[model samples]
Target: MSKRIFITGIGVISAIGKNASETLSSIKTASSGVGEIQYLQTVHKGKFPLCEVKYDNTQLCELANIDPKTRITRTSLLGIIAAQEAWRSAGSPVLGDGRTGVFSGNTVGGMDKTEHFYADFMQDAQSGDIKTMLSHECAESTERIADSLGATGMVSTISTACSSAANTIMLGARMIKHGLLDRAIVGGVDALTKFTVNGFNVLQILDEEYSQPFDENRRGLNLGEGAGFIVLEAEGIAKEEHILAELVGYANSNDAFHQTASSPDGTGAFLAMKGALDVAQIEPSQIDYINVHGTGTPNNDLSEGFAMQRLFGENIPKFSSTKAFTGHTLGASGGVEAVLSVLALQNKIIYPNLRFKTPIAALGGKMIPETALLENQDLTYILSNSFGFGGNTSSLVFKAYK
Candidate 1:
C-alpha cells in the first residue's frame, strides 16, 4: 500500500528571523531581509548586499545550546539548529530502529571553513588545522545533523546546486511512499561565504541592491544564507499526531540545455510542473497559488515566466516570488519557500510578490503579479517551483488537509 506523506512540523532560520514564528511574522509584514553584510567578514563588504542571519557562530551555538568550544562549521550549525526545532515541534519522536532517516541538502557544505583553512594553508602548509577541513565534503553536514538527531537509518545528502533542498524532500517522500522509512526530516542549509559571493559576482548576476524578482527592470540577485526544515511522516503516523499539510505531488526535470542558464522556453520547468500535476491527479486550474522560482535575474525570470505561460495558458493562478523578502538562498531557497508554501496552505493566504513593477513582455501579458498580500482565500492546492544550475528543475504540489 502506498502511504501519503504529510508535514507534521517545520523549523526555519533565515536573515528575516531565527525560527518559524519569526519567519511567518516577517512574511506577514512583508519585511525584506536583504541588506548590508553583517556577520560574514568579507572584502566585498560595501560592494554587495546579502540577507545574512543575524547571529554569528557563537550566537548560533548559544541559540542551539551547543558547547561553544566545540568546533563546527556554520552550515552544520545552522542545519542542526533548524533540525532541532523541527524535531521538537514534531514531539521529539524516537527516530532510530531503522524506521526514520534524515535527508539534508546543501551546496557549500564546509566551504566557509575550507576557505579559511585554504588561506592559512597557502601561507604555510602546516598552519591550518587539517581537522577543520575534514568537514569540507558535501555530505559532512548531513552526517553531523543525523548524528545529532540520533537518526541511524538512511542518512543522505543532496547537492544539486539551488534545487538541493527540494530534491531532498522529494527523496524523503519517495522513501516513505515505498515503505523504506516511516518518517524523515528533510530540508537544506547554506551559510554565506566569500566563495559564493565572488563566484556570482564573476557571473555578473549578483545584484548590489535588493533583488526585484519579476520586475521589468530587474538587475540581478542578492545572495543570502539560511536554513529551513520540515518533518515528514506517513499518513498513519501523522494521524496519531498533528498533521500540517499533505505533500501530494513532486517531480523533477532537467533541461540539459545550458550549464548555468535555463532554456529560454523553460522546457524543464514545464515538464516538472506537468509531471507534478499528473502525480497529484489535478488540473492546471486546481492550483490556487504558485510560489514561483523567480530569482529576479533576467534569464531566470524570463525563463520561468515563459514556462508558466506555456503550462497555465491565459488563466494562470495568482503567483508571487518570496525571494524578494528572503533573498535568493541558493540551496536553501527551496526548503525556505516550501515552509512558506505550507504556511500559505494552512492559513489560506498568498504573499505579495514584493518589488514587482512590470511583467516580462515575453510572457505576452498572460501574467498578473500578486503585489498586495491577500488573505482569507480558500486555497486547495499550491505549487512551488525551484530551478537550479545544470538546468535542474523541480516542482512540488502542496494541498490543504481539510
Candidate 2:
C-alpha cells in the first residue's frame, strides 16, 4: 500500500490575508480583499479592480527577512515568505539532508521585473539593470524558495497555467508515496505584471468591478497576485498533533478543447474530479463541500457547473468559489485554494462565495453556490478544483485527519 500524505503546515499571503489566521478571520466575516488597484503600476489602474497583497516590494522584502538591496523578483520574495512560514510551522525540520524536496508552480515567474528591464533597455541598450533579469525563469523562484528552506532533494517547478500549484502538490504526494522523499514543501506563487494584466484585458475576460462567480450576470475574472505553500509529510513521519489534513486523493486531466477555454461540456473537469474520487475510493456523495474553480467567467462557470452536475447529479453538495475574495491568482490559485480547503476542514466552516446573486439559468437555476458562511457543521471530505487555460484541470480531495 502507498503511504498516506498529510498536510502539517500551511502559509498564504493573499489579498484576503497574509497568513492562515488572518485568512480565517476574513472568511468568518465574509470580507473580500478585491478593491481598487494600488500597488501595481498599470495603465488600467482606475478601470480594473485587482486584489494585490497590499505591500510594496521593499515592505515584502522586509517581511521575507531578505535584504532590500538583494536583486530578487517579487515572485521570489512572495515564495520565500510563504515557504518560510510553512517550514517554521512544520517545526523547522532539518533539511538539506537529501530527504526533503521543494515543488513550486508559477506562470509569470519574474516577468514583472523583466517587463521593466526590457522597457529601459529598449531606450538605451545599457540603460536597464542587468541584475533584474537574473530571476527570470519559472525555476528561479522555485530554486530561491528551496534554498531558503535548505532543501537539497528533488526540486521541481510546474507551470500548467492555473492548475500549476495543484499539480505541484500532487507531485509531492506521489513522490512521498513512491519513497523518493520523506517530505516536501509544495505550493505556487505569481506576482502581478503589465504583461498578464494587459493580456487578460485583450482577451476581454477581466471584470471591471468585483467578480460575481456562479451568478447569472457574471462578467469576468479580476486578476490578483499572491503566494501559498504547504508542508506535506508521510503518515509515519508527521507528528499526529501537527497534522492538519490528509491528502487522500488527487488527479489531473486535460480536454484539449481549446487554447484558453474549457469545453462547454466540462469533459476535462469531470474527468479530473472523477479520477480524484476514484483515487480516494470514495463516492461522489461523500464530498461534504466543494471549492469550485469558479473564475467568474461565463464560460468557466457554466462549464464547471455542468461538470458538477454530471458528477454529483441532482444532489450536488454545497459549493462556492473564493476567487471573489482574492480574485483569480492565476498560477497561485490552486495553492491558495488548497490552503483554504485545509483550513475549512480543520475549522468546519464553508466560506461564502462573495457577491453571488442569481444562479446560472442554464443549470435550471439549481446550481446555487454557498453565498453565506456556514459554521459549526460536519465537514469531513472536501474537494478543491483548479481548472486552467488550455483545458488543464486538476482536483484534490482533502479529508479531515481523524
Q: In angstroms, how far off is 210's CA in candidate 1?
A: 0.9
lDDT per residue (tens digit) for residues 1-402 in model 1? 588899988888898898988988888898989989888889889898998988999999998888989889999999988888888888888887888889989998999999999999999998989999899988998898888889998999998899999999999999999989999999899999889989899999988888888888789998889888889999888754568889999999998899999999999999999999999889999999999999989999899988898999987899999888888888888889888888898888999988888777767755767998899989989999999998899999998888
Q: Give lDDT: candidate 2, residue 39.
A: 91
Candidate 2 lDDT tens digits, 10-47: 99999988888888898888889899999988889899
- Candidate 2: which stretches are off by over 4 Å? none
All candidates: TM-score: 0.98, 0.99
Query: Top model by TM-score, which number?
Result: 2
- Give the distance in Å from residue 246's predicted Cα in candidate 1 to where it truly belongs: 0.2
